[model samples]
Target: MSSIQSPKKGTHSVGVARQYSGTAGRIENCQVGVFAAYASRWGQALIDRQLYLPKSWAGDPARRDSAQVPDEVAFATKPAMACEMIARLLDEGTPCAFVLADAVYGSDHSFRRMLEARGQAYVLAVRSNHTLRFLEDWSLVQTDPGTMIADLPAETWTPLSAGEGAKGPRLYHWARLPLKYQAGQGFSLWFLARRSLRDPGAIAYYFAYAPSDATLEDLAAAAGLRWAIEECFLRAKDDLGLDHCEARSWHGWHRHMSLVMAAAAFLARIGADQRRAAYGKQNETSPKRPAA
Candidate 1:
């Protein structure tokens, strides 16, 4: 999910309010949209989205009518919007390996339960102070991330790269602890943590649910995939003017986003094709050594 900063001066524009925008790195008057991006080794692109309607906007009949918001539309939290979009894609038979999201969506219990109910694996970020229930010694143990990390053996932390960034591989010390909780008969739960190599105090936490055989590497890689959505937001806004919508109506905002998503999807397809072609060319032109 991301927020689009509006240049409009008033609150008349649909979904525009003083909210925290990760794009601006601060609270600003903007429209927030929960987006779903399809990501894989092949490529990534924005596939679906929902314009968030604040309670104020939803309750204000004057504003709703003025903005032409449909009567059926009501205020839904960002996490709810995210679930709706994700569920829609899954219901449409989209292939998914694992879901990845930031703390906002991850912190929501209903959101987590929805994913678990579908038997989908996910690595969702949580706050450092987020608590979890772990079964230890036949007793339920309640602990937060900080306490759990402090109790882990130093040797348990493994250095790994989440994914490639602008500088290079994003490396960190990662560790995981099995929560001993099962979502279903064969499911497993875990608490995963990543500590900055340079600043140990800087850490991130995640709750992972997957098959029991899922490895530390699998959870770490899935956690890193969250960046793909961020990249989608950047490309959409910078190249496709996703935030340039001047629409003051609900339908208008959605229409603009739909257009931007389509353009982004087209570009992703072109890039994927180019990459495959380049790889084929490289393979064909390579000098073949005689079989020894």
Candidate 2:
């Protein structure tokens, strides 16, 4: 579970300023927080993070001095940072199924391309205005929403649940539009849409690259995993002091974040063990059905 935000600041705190969309529209301040979290049926937890440093702060020695930014702190675009993390984690034998993120990473063409090249699949969120390409005579041509999945017939939409939520299974009407490109030996591209059952006019979109045999249920499951990242962020901050960093230097900030993630991971492991134990007990006490 991973997400990014500009942390709140007080007079004495050292924070990196970044733009955020809030009630005020867009605001900037001195804090950038990016994190990675682990999620599963038993529990979810934030496990890692990369603090964002703005270009302004990175290039200015004077600004760095005031903030006590470490000499090693360097500029890294959000997409690049995300790519690095994903690749490194996968390389380290992390059980990555499909990459999932909000529009920030989804809109990054290079990031999507990178994933394709690596033979990794992803179901990434995107804005309404993103373009798509159409396959024609074995060639791809730049096109509009037809390629972007806008003009689908009413019957194309299917009701599906991305995953379970706080109340129950999260349901939405889903439709998939095939893309011009085949990702690779094991990949395929498509534009996935989710419409509200009550308000069909309201729609959300995602761009997905998955295996040729991947079903809509598989893509929906990956899309639903994005929700876990948000939940991980909230629980970590509330229970594990995730945003309580007081560090003014790069090392200090990372150290604080790492410690918080460690705590969260520890708790998640304990929670998983407890759930497994309870599940075992339930099985033991339940009456067995007669053999057929």
Candidate 3:
């Protein structure tokens, strides 16, 4: 989810309020939109979006009517909007490998439960001080992530590259610890931690639910995929004028966002096709060795 900051704080535009804007890295007069993106090895593009209606606007009938908010549209949390989008994706049989999200969604119990109830695998970031539970010597032990990681031995940390970035491989020391509670018979929960090699104190926490056989590397990779959504937001805003909406009505904002997402999907398809063509050409030009 991301927010588009508005130039003026006037009470005209729909969903515009003084709120947290990730783009600005601070609270500003903006409209927040919860978006769902489909990402894979081939390409990534936004598939769904929901404009957040704050309680103030939802309770005000005058504002609702002025902004043309539908009668069925009610106030919903960002995580709830995300869950609805994901449910639609799954119902439509959209191919998905793993769900990835940041602390905003990860810290919500209902949001996490919704994903687990559907038997979906996910790796979600959480706060360093987030509470955690695990089994030790046939006993359930409760602790926060920071305390748990601090108690681990140095040998437990495994250095690995999460994925390639603009600079090079995004290297970090990662570790995973099994949780006591299971999502289901075959599913497992884990507490995953990552720390930067340059600054060990720069650490992040994640909670993952996946198959029991899932490796630390798999969880790390899933965690890294969260960047895909951010990249989508970046490309859409910079290239497609995603945040340039001047609409005051709710329907107007939705219409603009929908059109922008369509354009982004089209661009992503073209990029993927070009990449495949280049790969095929390289293979065709290379000499093949004779089989023995």
Candidate 4:
């Protein structure tokens, strides 16, 4: 966890105009979400992270040297760090079928291109106002891309459960619209949206690239995988001390985060095994039907 100093500096601690906060606000809002990665369902127990070294800390060679921060310790943007982590995970043989993230990473065109260059498909969320080319000539399109999707026949919107939530299944209405972008082989681009059945105006938008064979169900499933990451964050922080790090230096941050991730992975493995065993037992006790 880290702090931001400037009030006009950080928008929730991510700079507004690509700048860092000053000391005052950082000291006030002190603790922040320690940037860390939890395993995707099949990901390994590797700890991949990059620490954000504030200019106040990074600029001073004396503090850097004291904390054993190496000479190569330089400031890096969050998106750059996320990309670096993803690249390293890929190099380490992590199985990545698709990429998913909120607007922070999704809004970066360069980062999206980087993933495409690696031949990976993605379903990234963006704010409602985020613009895209619905047609080859977007200017010529009569209706807004969002309106185009919204105006689709009611039958086109599928009601589905994204996953098992605390109350049972998390259900929503989803629709998609084909965009004019001709992507790489075996892939196609589309605009995906999800709206709550209870509130029509409440909608979330996503830009997706997936195999030509991918269905709305498939895209929805990929989009829902982020919830698992959220669960892991809660588990790591609440049960495993993920946010309790006292590290101030570059190396110290890495060491602290790595250890926390390791412990979190351990807890995750145990929980997964328990669920599997219970599932197997339930199957064994269920009644079998005679052949028709």
lDDT of 4 by residue, 1-292 (tens): 1122223323232211233333332334342332434445443233455556556656777766766777886766556667777777778887777877776676667767778778888888776766654444445544444666667888888997776678987889988887777588888888888889899778888878888899999888778765566666666667867666655545665676688777877876777677666763536568776679
The local lDDT score (0 to 100) that residue 224 gets in candidate 2 is: 83
Query: What does the lDDT come to for candidate 4?
Result: 0.65
Per-candidate TM-score against the hidden true structure = 0.92, 0.88, 0.92, 0.78
- Native-vs-model 2 lDDT? 0.76
Stretches > 4 Å off in candidate 2: 9-15, 21-25, 135-147, 280-288
Question: Model 2 over residues 127-214: C-alpha lDDT tens digits?
Answer: 7777665678889777554345556777888889988877998899988877767569977898888888888768878888998899
Q: What's the distance in Å from true for residue 85, model 2? A: 1.0
Clashes of 3: 0
Residue 208 deviation, candidate 4, in Å? 1.3
The ten-residue window of minimal lDDT in model 3 covers: 1-10
Clashing residue pair totals per candidate (backbone < 3 A): 0, 7, 0, 5
Q: How are the candidates ranked when ordered by TM-score, highest leading?
A: 3, 1, 2, 4
lDDT of 1 by residue, 97-148 (tens): 8988889988899999999999988898898888777677889888888888
> Which runs of model 1 end up more than 4 angstroms from their true locations?
1-8, 134-141, 280-292
The superposed Cα distance between candidate 4 and the true structure at residue 127, in angstroms, equals 1.5
* Candidate 2: residue 222 lDDT (0-100): 81
Predicted candidate 3 versus true structure: per-residue lDDT over 51-75, tens digit per residue: 8998989899999999999999999
